[model samples]
Target: MPRSIDSFNRQRLITSYFSVTLSITLVLFLLGFFCFLVLSTQKIANHFKEQVAVTILIKDNAKSADIAQLQKTLSVAAFVKSLQFISKEEAAEKFSKDIGEDFVTFIGTNPLQNAIDLSLKAEYAEPEKLGEIKRELEQNSFVSEVIYDQSLVALIHENVNRIGLITLVFSALFTFVSVLLINASIRLSIYSKRFIIKTMQLVGATRSFIRRPFIRLNVRLGILSAFIAMLLFSLSLWGIVKSYPEFSILVDAWILLWVFLGILVMGILISWGSTYFATQRFLNLKTNALYY
Candidate 1:
């Protein structure tokens, strides 16, 4: 009976060790998911920013050289995220296609004006800031006018702001819930080890000496789980880019780097915090409580 009891205890310990590891892995996964969500949101916001167009109407007789120069200048503008030039011929063709049935015949010539299509950065997408940017662009001598949907831009900016706020709230909520779950998991995992902690304390073991191995184990678990989560995120991103090639920019090096670093930080922080609290609770228990 004594030998059978010993085997049972041994099996229980091994099972609990794995259960704790799995819990930590889950927490790390959640953290990475949240990081990816944030990065995706920012990319979506940039899509909106790139869609806020400002048309730069050129003079009827503006030379090709002047238009080329204007394009170069607009490309370098602080507010501009993207710029494209539309020649009179292309504009006329587009208008005719939209109107249908040879509207070009009534005009006899391409009466459509040449223009530069400008997409502003998100920072300048705000209605008031955009108006100021438009006014600045209009000051150029070759620019006949700058035109875009003022109300539409305003609406986009407002919607983006609301989305940003909602994302922040959701992230906070996820974090809170994740932390609580981690704490519970760690407590359960460490509960079985309480007797050992009390025995060490009775034997005059230093707290640092007791904590070092556990902390190291927690750190290793954090790193491995975080790497796995990041790998999954990368795979998901690659699949998305493959399916929708137009959004290739979302999988750019900079964005991927940001996501990787964010996941690592989140994993390390949450794991370390959960382990610390779990160990603290164990150390604080009354000696008699360990037997329970």
Candidate 2:
């Protein structure tokens, strides 16, 4: 080959490799960011679940001993995240303070009901589970009607699901676009070596043998691209931490590892897909097509 032709091919291959690497990086970065958002939302959901406080009310005539026993039972229940025993006097005082009004004028006697304010862990903090818990508590002889803000709980559940669906939709759209870009880059990368592919085919190279070098190159490209993508993701997270210092708590090393792994896997899959299609196209070309 002429020196100029060799130099041109060398530059083309280099450029093609870089293009594939950059495209894979872009795709993985998008995917990683999407994963991060999902994980962050899940963390927020956990915090929300932890804050869902459950209030259990007892009958006015219930014995103190029975209420204590109930509290103890709840404290050990599988669904109970935590339990706080609110005595009648304490509840009344809290209500009075919350309202910022004295009940002394309206009440001839203390009509305050005994109650136990329970706070569940994040895992058990769903509407259906909460309803079941409330039902169980109400079945107790010492317990009166269980009072909880049902509307608020329902609203929260509905919003959480709605937000989750929106996130999924956005992620899917982004993923579709990324797949096309990455595949196109990989295909173009392989296409640049089409003449060499034709030479190998004319020499009776099996499809697998012809694809071996590309696959090997692709594997390396996948790793390199994944690292690049991970670096970008880490930078994004660092930006986030800089903007909101509080986010550092959730941005731990394990989460970063998950992002790295996800990026690497995405890179490998996309590279493999691109190589497969490119090789198939080249192999199917007529002998005269090589001159083109």
Candidate 3:
């Protein structure tokens, strides 16, 4: 009878520990995922921003040498991500293909002007910055006009800001919920061993001594749970990269390393703190209070 009861209690203890570790792992994974989203928000925004192009129209009478000089100047500009020079002939050909008719033949002349299609870096894809760039380019002697989709630029900027704010709010709320969940799991795991805590205290065990073993065990649980969470997080990232290969550019090794380290630290701190406090509560309870 004694051996059977011992076996049952041991199995229950193992089950309890497993449950606590799994709970903590899941919570940590969610927290890590939110952190990754917050960090990658800017990178995702920049990818969209760089897709819009600004067109610089060239004067019809501009000399080849002057056009070449202008191209060189724009190539070296801080705001320019990339630029492509389109000749009048090439532009007219592309337009004709788009409209499925030879407009140049109907007009008896190629009416399209030579232009440079400019792709600005993500940071400069703002209304104010684009306006400044347009004004700057229009001042050049060989440039006739500089134009881009101002409405599109404004829309992208607005949407990116809105999404970033929403993501930040969600991340903060999720972090708070994660902490509470991990704390509760740790407290329940300790609650199952309250009698052991009180028994040791009754047998002349000091408070610090009683806490030391629980703290050490919970810390180890935290480390193990953190590793498992990191593994799940990494698998999720791998799945994302596999589905949308373009997003692979946003995955920075250094940033991911820091995020994983943060997760590990959070797990350790929360577990240790929870275990310490939970054990302290039981230690403070009187002998009669142990039943309730």
Candidate 4:
């Protein structure tokens, strides 16, 4: 009968420890996932912004030498990501295909002007910045006009800001909740060892001496939980990359490393703090209170 009871208690203890580890893993995974989401959103926003281009129309009588100089100057500009020179004929061909009609043939002349289509870097893609750049470009003698889609720029800027704000607010709330959940889990796991703490105190062990082993154990558990969560996170990222190859651009190995380290730091801090506090309560409890 005694052997059976001891076996049952040991099995129960193992099960409890497994459950606590699993809980910590889930919370860490959630935190890592939200971090990835915030990062990916920023990448996607930059991708869209870089796709916007300004069309610079050249004057009818602009010299080829002047056009070449303008192209060289624009290529070296801080704001420009890239530029392509479209000759008047190329512009007419594109326009003809776009409208599904040979307007040049119908009129026996191409009214389209030679133009430079240039995309700005993400940082310079804002409306105010683009406005400043446009004014600067128009000051050139060979330039006739600089045009871009104001409505599209405004829409992208607004939507990106909105999404960033929303993610920040929700990430803060969820991170707080995650800390609380982790704290509760660590405390509960320590609660099972309260009697051992009390016994050590009665045997004349110093508080630090009593804490050392439990703290070490908590640290180990925290690291183990972090690695487990990271493993799951890596698998999820792999699946996403496989399903949508374009997302591969957003997957930065350095950022993923930071995410993994962040989770590990969080795990260690929360577990260590919770274990220290939980042990304190037991250390102060009177012998009779142990029954409760």
lDDT, each prediction: 0.77, 0.81, 0.93, 0.89
Better of 3 and 4 by lDDT: 3
TM-score of 4: 0.93
Count clashing residue pairs per candidate: 0, 0, 0, 0
Clashing pairs in 3: none
Using lDDT as the measure, the top candidate is 3
Model 2, residue 205: distance off in Å is: 3.4
Q: Give the TM-score of candidate 3.
A: 0.94
Better of 2 and 3 by TM-score: 3
Flag regions of model 1 displaced more than 4 Å.
Answer: 1-10, 59-76, 107-110, 137-144, 240-247
| Residue-by-residue lDDT tens digits, candidate 1, 163-184 | 8788878888987887787678
Model 2: C-alpha RMSD to truth?
3.5
The regions of model 2 sitting more than 4 angstroms off are 1-11, 38-43, 59-62, 88-114, 245-257, 290-292
Alpha-carbon error at 178 in model 2, in Å?
2.7
Worst 10 residues of 4 by lDDT: 35-44
Q: What is the TM-score of each candidate against the true structure?
A: 0.82, 0.81, 0.94, 0.93
- Please give the lDDT score for candidate 3: 0.93
